[model samples]
Target: EDRLLPLSVEISEIEALGGPLLLHSWREGIDDVDNDGEADEWEYSIMREITPMKENGTVKIDFPSLELVANGEFGKVSLYITGTDLAGHPVLNGGAPGVDNDMATLVTQDDLPTTISQPSISLDRWGNNLLVGQIHEFSFSLTDDNGIGSIDNISIALAPGDSRGDIWLDPLSRELSVNDNSPIHPVGLVIDELAAGSYKVKIQFRLGVDSPQSWNTSTQKPSVIVTEHGQVLELGSNSLSHLEWTVDGRVNLMLLSADDLSPPHSELFGNTLYLQPDDRFNFSGQLHHPANGLNVILDGDWQVNFSMDDNQNNAENWYTILSDSSSFMATSEIPQSRWNHGSATVQATIVGGVQTIPITDMKLHIVIDSTPPQLDFPVTTLSTINSNQMMQQLVTIRVNEAGGMGQNPLELHWSFRRHGVEISNMHGAAQLPLATDAEGLWTYSTRIDFDVNSDLLLPGDDLVIWVVGADLAGHPLEGIGTEGNSKMTQLRVIYFQPVLSELTVSPYQPTIESVFTIDGRVLNEGNDMGVVKVGLWAWQSSGNGGRYHILNETNLTLLPQQHAFFTFSQEAWDSGDLQLYIAINDDDTNLTSVPVGLVREQTTGEILWQNIDSPAAVGLMILLISVVLMVVTAAIRRSDEEWDDMDEEEIPPPPPWAPDEWPEGAGPPPEILTQSTSLLEEE
Candidate 1:
């Protein structure tokens, strides 16, 4: 068993022996978790009782209970008792005598007369209108003849009601002696979250037992009138008193003139208003208080201004104070020259009493675009379409507006006219698709179908087209047309068929071996430009009703009202009567044929005739001529024999009777004999 000695020493005597009494390694198996080579985990405390050969127990120090009582000229004075133990811990139930809790208590001394005065209330802005849902501060001074320390509990209540629970006080009640060093104690009370109503503040004070007094009941109570936010209140000829009051809220603004079919077109998207320059616009607004649900009137005037920088000092005057009413209406216009593009701020300022307040909620952001959208037709004026065939042409228009085109759809208006007369059934408007390029330029394009069947457009018919739309700022498109004077583009419908005329073959009566040229003129009768194919064809008269064959073909490109001459050459072979003509665009010209008796030489002295009506009669005529030639040759032979027998000298006279140079129709036709003699000489 370990031996321990009992010792009793005063704290001053222990400090005089040394600075302090300290023990090391007071407990075994104490771990130094921090590895600092010290047993710091064990708790060190002064022991109230000593123990040996056993585990140490918790030590507690008890302090003596205290009670305080005072009697003053005011009455049995109220006292608040509070103290801490030797270890600086708060004493439980440490208050005035006979109190079960720690709260301050009042002493009972019925023999003394009460001398404490009631609290005097001094509101921050007394008799002034208070705004609902806002915090209002007021103070009350408590006094006593003996000092404010003699006063104890204070209670505050609202007369009529506190049922809605909308009103709240920061410090609900004052307990005990709030200020013991001062003769008067001023307590500030903050009233917050108050609803709209009228009430009287009732204050009660307690200096001793049965010493409670009501301040409002003893004097004339000042009423606290809480008004709805934004509700205007009369200042009661005390303008100086309103200097301490705050005027705050917002303004709800709207544009009254923004509508369809009006100048100065405007559109509102969220909080921003887009505007286009025109003549003028009407603006209206009403004052709104956020604290309460009400539209309130301004006590003074309302002014409006427009600024590019959102600063009132740099803003331009838009509207002056014309009325003192809460709601306002004004007319204003933005000049095109002054504001061509970009944004501006429209601010409203309220002049109330002697204070000028700018309502941030009243400011509206406006995007002004004064520049009108420009229109351009890439394929403009004098376009042609074929009426004979169906075709689709892309009509494109370029729109140049810096403010961009709005989300509204664009329309293409077109009208069809024939001979300067409008065709009602062919005129209408259609939505056009828009596209944007890398350069930020917008273009609208639509494919227009031009069909004679569907459109009923004939040659010389004109179609006019234009675009109509507005930009983001509601600026209308200007000069949007395909032609001059901002009018529409005219697309003329025309037929591209080619007409052939003046068909003529060289040497109208052609021989079988002759090369004949067929010449003709191709004219484009329609108001269209294209290639026209012209073909040369020949028809030979045979037993079987004339066989047709194409001789030659050529392509000729012709413009509207333009003519081109085409020629084709072909070797006419084995032809009796040949009909030749020029064909163009699926149409034929007048037929021209080669007549008979146009002869061509096959071999020397061999004749081939073209366009012969009878071949057997020609063969009989050849046989008769052959028989006459034989008889003449026989007579010439006999005459030659007789002449030979007569005399050799007589041969000179026989020269005049040359058989080769006979008269016409002797031996053969004179032309044939001469052609044979000439052919023999060339051979």
Candidate 2:
């Protein structure tokens, strides 16, 4: 072991090295701080004192200046001593307290490296896949260096694992050299050679050492997926996670699983699927097949990968397949033909089973020519309809046969007649415009005027407007005999004849009940034939010889000069002379006929309704008389008995006494009581 040497620094020299050096004695109570955990300002001044070597080269030296070192930090002091002419001696060897060597320097550095980071990895699905030559693409990124620095060549080895697919590169570079150091590596990725089956594609980036500070990333790897042909599909609108496409006919489909080593399992989106016999590139459009047709399968929800390769030389062609099972690819070379209808089969691959859905036999007939004709209304009824009451409202008629309803060459001829009279003599064929609907649908309205008199009324003359139209083939789809054009309506017309409809009597007859049947008829002179109901009236002459009294009414319906009989209760009146008045009215026609006189058949009942009163009176009189007679007889009998009780003499004597009692001067002779003399003589 070598002897210890004393180190010191001159105060002036300390100031030269950036700043003053801190120095302090090794003694106790050398508190350089205010006790506030911080060095006092004065402590800084003490640092200016850099100790030097003592008298001799050999001396006892202590590094007491260490106290001036910063707190919570370490301080290092190197010793550089210059020996005076004398050689430096070992301490305790009769040397001075300090020995100076050469100069000393201290250096420090802040913020040293501590921790290292690992890059992150991510994965996502490329869009959908194509049917035959489909390309499976994936995007990859990383956060940590693989081995030593940023990865450069990303060599992806996609082994179908168990899937079957031919990897393909479509016009783009397959070997991705991501050494450009962009924030986002390889903006795009495309995987070719995809087959039907589950796959485990291993992706590794060839790491390149770009900088001495670059980290090694040889161990970091990315993940990619390539689905099979028919097993995978994409539903354009639905967010289905899994989709399976089933093929039909001479073709079959197989599901190719994603690379097993890939981070995320491969999924087939079903909602993005669009299967049509038409172009596969256009997904959100209607597909029409003239020949082999198209088919589509809608799997509920299940991840399915597909693979297919077919060269059917039919009109139907196969477009791209979707990523999920919800949609599939149709591989047909059939073009749009002139078939009335075509059919196709759509198959869906499901977890538990598979579905084969058949398309329509053929698409609907689409009229390609959209040329529509214009329609004007010289006589056409306005879209706004109004209620009219006057003679059948006569709306003028006009039609431009040329520019009518469709692009196909067509002609129209029309004729109008009112009340069986053809009125087209004035303005026969008024030219009109084409239909208003852009679709070119034929346009005709119920706007005919039969009566020339009333604008607010429907023509009453049984007006008829005849229309005749013919196609380019001379196939007339109009006219009276046309399958669909002949229509008829009654113009402002009326039932000219009148028929008695109803005639009824009040209270029915009381004593003699009778019902009379009145038959009558009327002629129908109107252009339109219809039923007319007419009412009749009857009046009877009172027995008092006064004017005739109304009795009852009858009604009947007459059909064009036809007659009818109406009968009502004749029991309403007694037999008497009655005048018959016939009134006929057509309710629907709103026309009333004049009252006509009809011969009255006399109805007679000798026993008027009042006969009931006479019988009742006779009965009451007989009962009164009987009662009075019985009372009178009882009184007479009583009186006779009383008389018998009294003597006859008493009665006679009472009468003579009254005569003699007459005033004395009034009677010259008084009749004597002869009853007593006669009784004496007889005795």
TM-score per prediction, in order, is 0.32, 0.23
lDDT of 2 by residue, 90-188 (tens): 112111211122133232222122111112122222222112112223323322211211111222222122111112222122444432331112223
List the pairs of residues colliding in candidate 1. Answer: 576-611
Worst 10 residues of 1 by lDDT: 204-213
Q: Give the local distance difference test score of model 2.
A: 0.31
| Residue 16, model 1, lDDT | 15
> After superposition on all CA atoms, what RMSD does each candidate show versus the true structure?
26.0, 29.2
Q: In model 2, where do residues sit more than 4 Å from their true spots?
A: 1-129, 132-149, 155-416, 419-532, 535-560, 565-683
Report every candidate's CA lDDT: 0.46, 0.31
Q: 217-335 in candidate 1: lDDT tens per residue?
A: 22212322212111222212111222233223223433333332245355655456667654355556665545453554443344544333434235565555535455666656656
> What number of backbone clashes does candidate 1 have, counting pairs of residues 3 or more apart or in separate chains?
1
Winning model by lDDT: 1
